[model samples]
Target: MKRIAVVGASLAGVRAAQELRAQGYDGGIVLIGSEAHLPYDRPPLSKAFLAGTVSAASLELLDAGDLASLALDFRLGVRATAVEPAARRVLLSDGGSVHADGVVIATGGRARTVPGWSGVHTLRTVDDALALRAALVPGVRVVVIGAGFIGAEVASTCRSLGLDVTVLEALDAPMAPVLGPALAAVCARLHLDHGTDLRCGVSVTAVGPAGVHLADGSLVPADVVVAGIGMTPATEWLAGSGLTVSVGVCVDTGLVTSLPNVVAVGDVARYGGRRHEHWTNASEQAPVAVANLLAGRTSRTYSPSGYVWSDQYSGRLQLAGHPSPADTFSVVDGELSSSSFAAVWQRNGETVGVFALNNAKLFNRLRRPLRRPAVV
Candidate 1:
């Protein structure tokens, strides 16, 4: 391949380009991004960036010297409007086209917004984080919608800044869908212990400039509201492109799309019928996607080493492997009261997952074993 066009200049796209060069492909590399800024880390946007502990420059994944060394044709602030699979070209919003032998789609996703919510905010970009941070001054009333990873982090950051925080969730417990109700209850208590006013099993009817209106006709007074409900794949540009896109761009085990000479990675690529929205997943898939682009059918197949972590109130929670709702969980080491422990999830007498709280050492040790097909 003489040239490769990589759509989305985020982590996955940047890693793919790096791997392509590392694999000895000295072709013309074009890294296209919708955002004006060069590729920057997204995980820190909620924590360090919002807290003003990290600057925008520190979020950059590649510096000027490194970018210059790569000799990449970096196209920032341009959106890829469409992909012509047959012609092997990407159409940009600026009325330009990039022709390449192969294309990598890593557009990722954006936070889902609630309709008619004028004052409510969602954090998914650097700009979003900065705006939210400005509103999170001391003594402000902050209401965070949803109790998922992003929501919890936002609440924690708000509390750290001496703001009064409240979290609203439709489910009975935080992260009930992922950790199940039993363990999710433990996570719920974590927030309550930290002075978070958590209201579960409640529905928000509407959000206005005044505050969040509940189903029971009660309004939670909020100076600033943040929504971390969820995210939707940024795939609108792929319409009529002959690519199968459900919740995200459908890709096979090898990360190959339905269209020819094209593959996708990161939060935008739905591999094995599921889109993993974790940073590690993107890092893992990049090398595999690049290999397939260079080696065609001879490339390695992708197998997800399921892993995710969250930070809240000086404690860290980590999980490895996949745990279904039907899986049985058991505390194998430590205790929840101690705030440091390891738990294992089993299904059909086989270990399927492992979780740790404030136990990074044990979490790292158990990751490999949890990833095994059969762990006794």
Candidate 2:
């Protein structure tokens, strides 16, 4: 392939371009991004960046030296409207098209916001974070809807700023499905322990300049409201593009789409019926996807590490492997109530998942078994 077009200049796209160069493919690369800013780290957007501890420049993934070495044709602030697989052309929003030998779709996703709500915040991009950060003044009342990872992090940051914060969750136990009941309860306590008004199993009816209106007709007065519900994969542009798209652009185990010359990655890709929004998943899929794309077929199947981490309050929570509510939970070290512990979920005799809160050392040790490659 003489030229390859990588859509979405975020983590997955940048990594794919880097992988191409690392694999000795010194061909032309066109890296396209919807956002005007350079590709930057996103995990920090909800944590340190929101807390004012990190600078905007510090979040950048590639510096001038790195960009020069990669020799990428960087196209910033442009959106991919459609893909013509047969012609190997990508239609952009700016009335232009990029014709390449191979195309990589890594458009990630966009934050979901409440309808009929104006001026309410939803954190996804750097621009969204900046707007929310400006609204999060000291002594302001912050109401964060949804108790998922992002909502919890926003509440934690608000508390850190000495602002009045409240977190609302539709589920009785936040993240119960992912972390299981035993561990999720531990997350609940962390909020209360930090003086956050966390209400569970509540339904929000509406949000406005006044505050968040509950299903019970009660209003949680707030100067700032942030909806951390979830994100919708940015696949609207790929409509009628001849690629299978459902929740996201559907791809096979090798990250190859319906078209052999095109592949999807990151949050925009629903691989093997699952879409992972984790940084590790996006980073890990790039090399394998690039390899398969260059080979003109599925030469390598992508193996997920199932690793994800979150920073909340004053603790670091880490998980490896898939942990479901049905799995048998066991506390291997420390206690969950103490804010520092290591635990595991097992099915029969095999360790299926591992979790740690503020206990990275033990977490790493326990995660070793999960990271081992299975024998053929």
Candidate 3:
């Protein structure tokens, strides 16, 4: 390929570009991004950055020298309208087009927002964090909708700043689908222990100036509201692009879309019937996708690492492997009520998942077995 266009300057896209260069592909790379700023780390946006503990510059994924080495035709602040796989061209919103031999669709998802609610804020970008940070002040009653990782992190940051925080979850338990009821209860306790008024199994009807309106006619008064429900995959631009997009841009194990020349990665890619929005998943899929894209077919299959970590309250939460409610959970070290512990989920007799809180060493040791690939 003479040139490759990588859509979305996200972690996955940046990694894809780097992988191409590393693999001795000395071709033209057009890194397209909708954001004006260079690709930056997004994990800190809801925590340290929102809490004013980290600067914007510290979040950059690449330095000036590193970026210069990649030899990228950086197209920042422009949205990709559509892709023509057969013609090998990407249509841009600026009335321009990027014609390349290959295309990488890494357009990650955007944070879900509440419509018709001007007062509600959703944290996804640097601008979103900055806007929310400015609104957060002393004694502001902050009500966070959704008790997922992002919502919990936002509430934890707010509480750290000495703000009154209350988190609402539509489900019976936060992260129940992944953590299951047993471990999910531990997550719920973590919020309560940190002095957060966490309410589960609640339905939110509307968001007005007064506060959040519930279906049962109860109002949760708040001076500031943040919606951390989830993210919607940014696949609107690929509507007529001939790629199978179901919730996300559907791809096979090789991260190759329906078109041989096109591939996807990160939160926007639904690989092997599952889409992981984790940082590790995004970074790991790039190499495989780049390989398959260059090979023009499925040469290597992508396997999920199933690793995710979060910082909230006093401990660092970590999980590895695919854990479901059906799996049996047993604590290996320390107690669940304690500040530090490591646990594993078992299916029949085989261990399927591992979880830890402030116990990195043990967790890392236990994670190795799960990382081993199965013999076909």
Candidate 3's C-alpha runs over 4 A off are: 373-376
User: Scored by CA lDDT, what does every candidate get?
Assistant: 0.88, 0.90, 0.92
Q: Estimate each model's TM-score.
A: 0.96, 0.98, 0.98
Candidate 3: tens digits of C-alpha lDDT, residues 1-376: 9999999998999999999998889999999999999999999999999999999999999998888899999999999999987788999999999998999999999999877866899998999999999999998999999999999999999999999999999999998888888778989999999899999999999999999999999999999999998999999999888899999999988899988889999999997787899999999888889988999998888888899999998979999998777778899999988889999999989888999999999999999888854111
Candidate 3: give its CA RMSD in angstroms. Answer: 1.4
Clashes (candidate 1): 0
lDDT of 1 at 153: 93
lDDT of 1 by residue, 1-376 (tens): 8899999999999988898888889999999999998899999988889899989999999987879878899889999999887888899999999998899999999999878887888999998998998888777899999999999999888888888999999999999888887678878888898999999999999998889999999999999999998999999999988999999999988898875478899999997779999998899888778887887652577877789899987779898899887888888889866688998888888878988999888778777666532111
TM-score of 3: 0.98
Candidate 1 clashing pairs, residues 3+ apart or interchain: none
| Model 1's TM-score against the true structure | 0.96
- What lDDT score goes with residue 373 in model 3? 44
Give lDDT tens digits, candidate 2, residues 153-260.
888888999999999999998888888788889999989999999999999988888999999999999899999999999999988888999999999888999888
- The residue ranges of model 1 lying beyond 4 angstroms of the native Cα positions read 372-376
Ten contiguous residues with the weakest lDDT in model 1: 367-376
